[model samples]
Target: MNTAKQRKASLPERGFAWAAAFLLALFLVASLFSLLAVQVMTSAGLHTGTATNDSVLDGQMKIIHNYIGVLADAYGFEAETVRQSVSRDELRDFNLNAAAWWTGVLAEGESRTIPRWYSPAMEQAIRNAVDSAGTGEDPNVILAEITEKIDRTVYPLRESLLTTGLDFVNKRADIPGIVRSLRQVPPLCLVLCILAAGLIALLAAREVFSSLKYYGTALAGAGLVLAAAGIIYAVMQLKAMLSQASANLADEFGTMMHTLFLEAGGAAAVLLLAGFACLFIYRNRFEKHMAPGEEQAA
Candidate 1:
């Protein structure tokens, strides 16, 4: 009669324990994925890699040269002469600076005007061309005209090249607020996961080995799901799914996605290993300490 009453009481506790374990699994997966996302989104190295991609920089320089060609045709200046003024090295330095500035903006939500290094370089090139050609006109007057044209034409192109498409989203949504919420998600999920874990332990207080089994099951379940997802994503070709309007953009997005999945996979592996270790300890060590009948029941 006493054993029957004990079993009856344990039924409710076991039910609660199962529920907590399920919640723990769910929260574990959520926290892991959210943490990976936050890290990828705010990674400076990733941003800089995208910014300094060879194809992207090459494309920007090509457009700039094309604009200079148009200006040369209109103002009777040599296109090559102006193009030669800004060396590839100078353009590379400008991009490096721009990447640093963009990284800061993403992190701090502080805005700064992008420097117009190209404008000065192009303007001086035009002035040199006029002087070399012996145009007999005041170089300053010609410089002013070309400078105005550069402001109207090349400046917009420069802005487009250097931008990471955030401005478009910022205009439509509260990006800073969204980022703040994203930053908070992982820690919030972690706290809830801990609470669930604690609840499971409390519910199974009299059955310590049972709590270990529950924890092992929860962690293993979550790890398996996360790992499978990460592997699937890593193998999938994301570039085809992304907007092909800009090849450079697609490449960068793919790179970021790759990093995210790799981290997820790594985290999942750790969780899976830990879960298995717990289960192994419970089976080998804890079960041996139980009475023959209790061990058989377990």
Candidate 2:
């Protein structure tokens, strides 16, 4: 026991132990960030929240009204006349369905038909317009013309809104696969990190207490980096950065990013605390077991 106590780690062993600790820190940080991303992307609650957000709903309404205004312009009618025909409940349902469809497509790795409520609303608007005008024109003929115009205009808009511009080269189908792979990353990284930590303990120290120093250093380094990055990202003026985007989009994106970063920062704080605790234990408890020379070397 005395002979073992006097033994010191060789320079090569110390180098390898340090390398392992560094890799452990790297893997730990990667695992944390990847886990956060997976949680955000896979969360149904997040998607629902974004879909029902007032800003997002208002933006959708504005876009729909603009399309209605175009139809009114073409047919020589008041835009408000057409807008009045579509109820708020109908618009809400459409937005909800659109959100659901987007979630389904990404999860299932396939394209589904886009949700549509505009054409029916437009038809009702035209019928009201014809009645008010006393134009004596057959409503069916007007409906057919208007329907054709919608197919050319509104249908394309719906498609563009739903499809995320990754329609070519089968990239859209790859989304689900990518998400699956990401889901595996955190667990894999964690396992590798644990292995690296064990390697550091084995290669650098004869006593378990001595290994705590390396563990504390690696954990503290990783925690500091993650906490700083997360806090900085959360505090950035994301909405201002997205000024050119539609108001609703900017607000929703900025809010989402803020929430995500804050959560990350909170998680990193736990890690930072754990790291400090380990260091404290090593200094107060472990140092008593070592000779002055050994303690200084450690």
Candidate 3:
């Protein structure tokens, strides 16, 4: 150890330094919250193209497709056969409507009608086709009857369903707002953190080494707290929220919430590690810069 001692800081100067440190701590805390919020929003609400795979939305979509198939079968139509006839554009429209149904459940106090995918006339015609499918009816005649019925009736019904679904999709996600929020929050957090650090540095210019340990310890403590909270929240969300709900839309919402909570928890853990690292670095090496009693001596 170099037996070197620095002169003490004035009482006013010491108070100002500690005050600046406190402000810095607050800024760091804000930064942590903002970072986690951004992740949660992006994961749950933004619905990026790549994020769609295996997401709650994807799961919800499967449920929707199954529902449509079931509805068609209830009306005596071959659901799989009909679905096979759907074009890419029609399929896209149907998906949008299904997603709309999913979105309503996620919003609190939001009531929306579940779409009836087929008209009564369409159902009746399909039943008629099913009834006349066999029973010694001329083979070509029966086939012709069924084909004509579907071309005139079934395809029209499908187009209407597609139109309805497209309308729902148009209403669901607010793209511009989501993009704006994502962009704004992180930069704001960064600015606050930088300003805080600068304030601390300015106040502690004379005792730079001594103040660093305090800063590191604050970071470590905040990070650990956030990490622990995040872990607990993640566990609770997985157990209580991730399970599929009785309704298809509710199940999709559960998935969305689960993913968001998980991401938030991860962010907290990263913040915690960063804080601990800061504490370790200062405690082990930078603490030596203070000489342990600079302010007291002055």
Candidate 4:
């Protein structure tokens, strides 16, 4: 009983186990956080939130917004011209019936207009764009004009519309939520990492070489997991890129995304290698694998 009591008390003289566990946890989390950040930076739709330089979907979003805006202005002008001949009440009645029918026909997630301005005033001041798209002189010319008008009116709101892109607005609800959650991780992990490192250093000072084997194993496992994950993700990205239909997509954005995945994988690989080395050097308490001065470190 006396001997066991002395051993237990001696264990407190070595708080290195807690220190090792914390440090290991922090390192693994940091690698994961870096990988997630890389993923966000590489995606144009996602990068805006992280302040990553992006050319991906930002330009496209502006073009689409402008294209729709031009059509809206043209439709408004046409309707205003029509209202010049018709009485106000006639326009009101027509608008009410048309809006009711259009709204009734709309399926879930299908929006007739942005901002959904179905008010009487807007209705009277709007041409029936959906009904009159192809009923004009030279449909090709009309399309070209609309496209040009939109190009002229392009306004970029990329940074502000990171999670509000067309894809998400159309019902990728999960994406916005995931991004919001991920954006908070790096800072949280950083705090945890610093805390863990400080505690580990303190414990290490208190009990040198006390928990080397445990730390070594934990680090090695973390590294292996990270490396394996990165390798798998890189392979999957390569396969997906190969399968894409558009050449430009496959070559440009797809390649960029793939590269980002690989970068994550690379980070994971570094962690994995470091873990393996730690484990190898701390295989046993005997310190047989330690370098000349490494035992002092332990």
Candidate 5:
């Protein structure tokens, strides 16, 4: 009876187990929180907000914006111009042509800095047209001049308006939401603290379960999972980029990037915590596994 009583007293109460569990939980939660935050930002269209309407040394952005405006008009956006000035077919042509130009420019490494208000050819064409338009030509005459230049110079390339670009813009809008949530700072800090607590708890649990050798298995499994998540993320990113190039739905690509990079990363961290939890359980079990100093504490 005396020996049993002494051993029972020596064993830790429930508090130790609870603390370890809490730490492990926190670690997993923090990883997930980060993932969710990133996703929210991406979907809200804020990921590349800085890239919009900022100063352009050249008029490249203005041109792109103009194209966007034209596209919006084609979609029945009522502006100063009559809604029918550009037909849907015309818009499609413009979009296709612009995409081709962009692709070609990227291939040639000339896509980096958007040329100011005009490339050499565009500038020359515009100068000629504007000079004629300024001559107080009739409305039809002015339209004719502009149309001629556009047909001769712009229409020949692969300019086609498609819904793909619009879809990309629509999806990008969700990125702002994700960014807003992530930038809150306080919530993220809290999440980090929780994760830290979880890690500690997990370590404690490993100590408790030391006798079973479960910790080793847990760690090995965690390492593999983390590796897998990393690999998956990389593959997803590659796919997203390829889709961005080939498909019309740019927004979808952005979403995929967010999911694979942020969400998957969080999931992997959680897996790591599970491994730690196993370690803590192991540590609390077998005395032989403990270091000399820890053994004394036990």
Candidate 6:
């Protein structure tokens, strides 16, 4: 059995060294985890956006094509009027009118009378090809022909209805652009970086204080300084991370912002608990200030 003096001599002075080393390891793990998680989230968002955009653009093209077909059928114009061989100027005008109709939906509201000239131009062009028919008789025949064509073209109308089912794609587009456009660092990474940096700083402060230790008072003072510096570093980094998160929240995945906040808040709570544990170890192990007489009585 060893005497008190012998036992004391056997113990090394590196008392919180292992604990500090463990925290450093944890900090590194956390940093890597944050980096990987952000990469996964960002990649998923971009991939989803790409697939959704392709589907939406294809669906929109089909709807526009079907709508033009319906317009041609109703007017009973020559097939060439709507065919791809039409003059660029005429096609541009047609597209402008269609775009005007769509844009007007947001302003003048739906059910605006389509300009009379647009229908008559196509009707006159088709009617002029035939001769010797009564004026109203040709238009009546054209109207009946249009109705029959519509009844037969059920597939186009069905395909056009796909747009209504695809409203979700447009909503998804708004967010991915924001995510891609803003190439800032993720808040989680910044927070982890600050955490790792603070942990390293704490380890350094502990080493510095141990080297300067003239007495237990100096060692205790150094531990308190390390803990305080760690807390300050954590707070500053946390604030920067929060600011970045807030900017990202204004994004379309603003819904995801709530989720991110919950995750970050939970991480913060865990760190806070760990900080308190560090302080408890520091106070109990290093800062006991019992008087010499009290120590003798014990």
Q: Pick the candidate with the highest TM-score.
A: 2
Compose the digit string of candidate 1's lDDT tens values, residues 83-119.
7775666666666676676666666554557654555
Residue pairs with backbone atoms closer than 3 Å in model 1 (clashes):
none
The clash numbers for all candidates, in the given order, read: 0, 0, 3, 2, 59, 0
Worst 10 residues of 5 by lDDT: 1-10
TM-score comparison, 4 vs 5, better candidate? 4
lDDT tens readout by residue for model 4, 29-139: 575756466354333333222122233234333443445466546643343332333333432343344334222222122333321112343333233433454344343
> For candidate 3, lDDT tens digit of each residue in 1-298?
4344656567887777667656666666677677655554443343322224244335434554465466554444455543344343343444455444434432221334654333333345444545554333333342344344323221222444644655575478654445556657767866876776676677667756656655665566556666666666657765344244334334444555565556656765666676666667756663454465753463
lDDT of 3: 0.51
**Model 1, stretches more than 4 Å misplaced?**
1-9, 52-92, 104-112, 115-175, 231-237, 290-298
Q: What is candidate 1's TM-score against the reference?
A: 0.64
Better of 1 and 2 by TM-score: 2
Top-scoring candidate (lDDT): 1
lDDT of 4 at 146: 42
Stretches > 4 Å off in candidate 2: 1-8, 54-93, 118-165, 171-179, 231-238, 286-298
The regions of model 3 sitting more than 4 angstroms off are 8-16, 35-45, 49-51, 55-58, 65-69, 83-186, 228-266, 286-298
- Write candidate 5's Cα lDDT for 1-298 as tens digits: 1121212212353345344444434444444455454444333232222112123101222333355356333433322232234343443344344444443332232222221111333334334543544543333343443344334233222323323443355465653344355555546655654554544445445333332233334333544555665676567666566554533233424443554555456555666666666666655554555566756776
Segments in model 4 whose C-alpha atoms lie over 4 Å from true places = 1-35, 38-181, 198-206, 231-247, 280-298
Estimate every model's Cα lDDT from 0 to 1: 0.70, 0.68, 0.51, 0.45, 0.41, 0.39
Please identify model 5 stretches exceeding 4 Å from their true place.
Answer: 1-23, 35-182, 185-246, 251-263, 266-298
Clashing pairs in 6: none
Clashing pairs in 3: 8-298, 220-275, 223-272
Error at 247, model 6, angstroms: 13
* lDDT comparison, 1 vs 3, better candidate: 1
